[model samples]
Every structure is written in structure tokens, then in C-alpha cells.
Target: MFEQIDCPEAQRLVEAGAQLVDVRGPDEFARGALPGAQNIPVQVMAQQAGQLEEHKPVVLYCASGARSTQAQMLLQQLGFPEVYNLGSIQKYYTC
Candidate 1:
């Protein structure tokens, strides 16, 4: 299973320049997203994985925890060294 990072840790990662990604669909991301999040919906994440910085930590979230979990796993398989699932977008507000 992928690791579910806490809000504070997510915030710390963001503060330290982690790539913040929203793994929901484009429409859902258009509705709203955590501040500073970049939309890279899980559907096309593999194709766009190259857009993410390999040297930076990645933090991903979705409406629920599911999509982000998938994203985290993909990034890991793609050789991203520090990928984290921040779970739901709601968790960002808590941080």
C-alpha cells in the first residue's frame, strides 16, 4: 500500500518545494483544488509523469484518497524517489 502522509508533513513538503499535484479529473480540479496544486489527473499521469521534477518530492491528492493513492504508486514505479499521498484535498485546508 502507498503511504498516506499527514497534513503537517504535506505542508512541510510543500514549504520545502515539493510538487503539489491534484490527481482528480480536469473538471473536478477546475471546480477547486488545494492552493498551489497542479492538475495532472491520474488518467494521464503516466504520460505526463515526465513533467514532474525527479529531484523534488511529490505530494498528490484527490477528492478522496483513492486517486492520489494510484498516483503515488505510479510515481514510485516511475522512479520518483520521494512521492507522498496527501489524500483528499480537504486535508490541505487543515494544514
Candidate 2:
């Protein structure tokens, strides 16, 4: 199962080199996103999954927790070793 972490832990993970993926749409992403996060909408995550480096861990978040949870499952099914759901971007930004 994928682990769900809070904003503080997410920050630590990113600092430790975990890949931060914002699973929001282009418009949402264009507005703003966590610093260092790459935009990868959940709809296209499967196809773009390969672009992620296998050697590093991956953390996903969206507007709400739902999409990122789905993404976490998809990446896990694709054999990603460490997949974390950081829930909503609001949680991270407000922290």
C-alpha cells in the first residue's frame, strides 16, 4: 500500500531527493505548484510514468486527495518502489 504523508514529511522527502509530482491539470499547474514539483496530470500518468526515474522515490499530490490516491495506485501497479500521496497542494502550501 502507498503511504500518505503530511506536508512536513513531504518536504523532508523532497529534500532527500524524492520526485514531487503535481497531478493537476495544465491550467491548475500554470497557476502555481509546489516548488520543484513537475506537472503530470492523473489522466496521463500511466503513459508518462516511464519518464520518472526508477532510482528515486515519487510523491504525488493534486487539488484534493482523490486524484493523487488514484495516481499512487497506478504507480504502485507499475512497480514503483516507493510511492507516497501528499494529498492536496493546499496542505503543503499552507504549512
Candidate 3:
């Protein structure tokens, strides 16, 4: 099952070299996003799954929790070992 982690834990994972992916659209991502976050909108996340590092954990977020949660499920279904939902980037920024 995929896990939902809070900002502090997400930050810790990122610090430990986890990949932070913004599952929002290109426009939403272009507006603003967490530093070091890569844009891979949920729609194309499956196709781009191979771009993710196999050894590192992957943290996903979007404008709201919905998209990221879906993305988490997709990653897990694709056999990704460590996939985490960080909810909204806005929430992360506030943390």
C-alpha cells in the first residue's frame, strides 16, 4: 500500500535523496512548486515511471491530495517499492 507522509517526514525523505515529483499539470507546476520537484502530471506519470530512480523513494504531490493519491496508486501498481503521497504542495509550503 502507498503511504501518506507529512511535510516534515517528506522533507526528511527528500533530504535523504528521495525524488520529489509534482503531479500537477505543466502550467500548475510552472506557476510554483517545491524546490527540486519535477513535473510529471498524473496523466503521464505511468509513461514516465521509468524516469524515476529505482533505488530512491518517490514523493508525489499535486494541487490537492486527489491527484497525488491516484499517482501513488499508479506507481505502486507499476511495482515501485517506495511511493509516498505528500498531498498538496501548498500544504508542504506552509509546513
Top TM-score hit = 1
Question: Could you give candidate 2's per-residue lDDT for residues 1-95 as a string of tens digits?
Answer: 65579988899999999999999999999999999999999999999998899769999999989999999999989989889999999999756
Global lDDT scores for all candidate models: 0.92, 0.91, 0.90
Better of 1 and 3 by lDDT: 1
Candidate 2, residue 81: how far the Cα is off, in Å: 0.8
Q: For model 3, give the 10-residue run with minimal summed lDDT.
A: 1-10
Clashing pairs in 2: none
Give the TM-score of each candidate.
0.95, 0.94, 0.94
RMSD per model, one decimal:
1.0, 1.1, 1.1
At residue 59, candidate 2 shows an lDDT of: 90
Off by over 4 Å in 1: none
TM-score of 1: 0.95
Write the residue-wise lDDT of candidate 1 on 1-95 in tens digits.
Answer: 59799999999999999999999999998998888889999999999998899989999999889999999999999999999998988887785
**What is the alpha-carbon lDDT of model 1 when measured against the actual structure?**
0.92
lDDT of each residue in 1-95, candidate 3, tens digit only: 55578999899999999999999999999999899999999999989988998668999999878999999999888888899999888778767
Error of 3 at 63 (Å): 0.7
Alpha-carbon runs more than 4 Å astray in model 2: none
What is the lDDT for 14 in model 2?
92
